[model samples]
Target: MGEVGLRTVRDGQRVLRFQAAVIGAATSQRGSSPRWSELVVYRMVDGHYLISKIGRSTVAHQPTCLRVNHRMVPWSKAAAFGEDSVQRVPCPDCRPELGHGIAPDTMLEVTRYRAILCQTAESAAESLMGDRAALLMPQIVQTVLAQCSESDPNFSRYAEADTALPRAWENTTRTP
Candidate 1:
């Protein structure tokens, strides 16, 4: 209905921006930006069930909406909004999709396991690819690591730890 333009939605603390224009629309023929549904979905990059719906011009998620666009951006490039910005409301469409209420300790263990899994994958890729690994390993590792940390709300901390130097024992050997 309204003139199509870019859209933004707040997902938790982050602001996500995506093309309001659909992939194929009459607007494109006119040499203007494409036109997607007035509604757009914004999903959390960490693979969490959290998502948001934004209209032509708004910042907060529309919690009551029963449907949203299927297109998803893996992660958001927009910085988190400041305290002055509107707080995000949880979307009803995605709330039911949250994981079964698991115990906190179990969830912690799961996150740790995922971090280790990422580390192992990196090691394996480096070993198999050898010299050529460096060329693509960063991208591979980062994508895997981001996916693995999907459920982890504290992913930034884990990401920092992942780059830490290997243990002393890993780099040293004892002489007989």
Candidate 2:
């Protein structure tokens, strides 16, 4: 794994090992319904908005503030106060307009993370639960993994294929 850089530091702090991120049990109770945020919004695996801008203060961060790791307030929940309130609280860095959809770059990143989660779950289900289960169980897997990401950003770091799932058979993009 080390030969290909499968283990690395994430967030400049947490040591993110692929084995630790993808091999664990799903984070939610089996068979629970998906939350609204999990179903409708695209968010970082950690459920925080990716604040990409380097400067500026005062912006709203929905689903939680990345700077402070504050408790996340879902966009819908905050929008309940009206859009004006939503637009008023700017993040110190990203300057997100609360209730707005994710920034495009962030969407791409979130999509990558979601794809990794799906691929890993499918492989795991096939290995442990059989192919039929793999076919039938993706929604459950999505729900559980989404739940996990909401609470633990580390769970989201399975975003990189080379590091997260290194099997030759699993990597469709690799050449022989």
Q: Which of the numbered candidates is closest to the native, going by highest lDDT?
A: 2
TM-score of each prediction: 0.17, 0.19
Candidate 1's C-alpha runs over 4 A off are 1-136, 153-170, 173-176
The residue pairs that clash in candidate 2, if any, are: 58-90, 59-89, 59-90, 59-91, 60-89, 60-90, 60-91, 64-72
Model 2 residue-pair collision total: 8
Expressed as tens digits, the lDDT of each residue in 1-176 for candidate 2 is 01122322232223334322222223322342212112111123332222111111223443334554433334444443232232244454565553456442220001001212223333432332233323344453444444444544544633322233345456567656
Clashing pairs in 1: 22-35, 22-36, 46-150
- Which regions of candidate 2 are displaced past 4 Å? 1-136, 158-173
Q: Report the lDDT of model 2 for residue 131.
A: 32
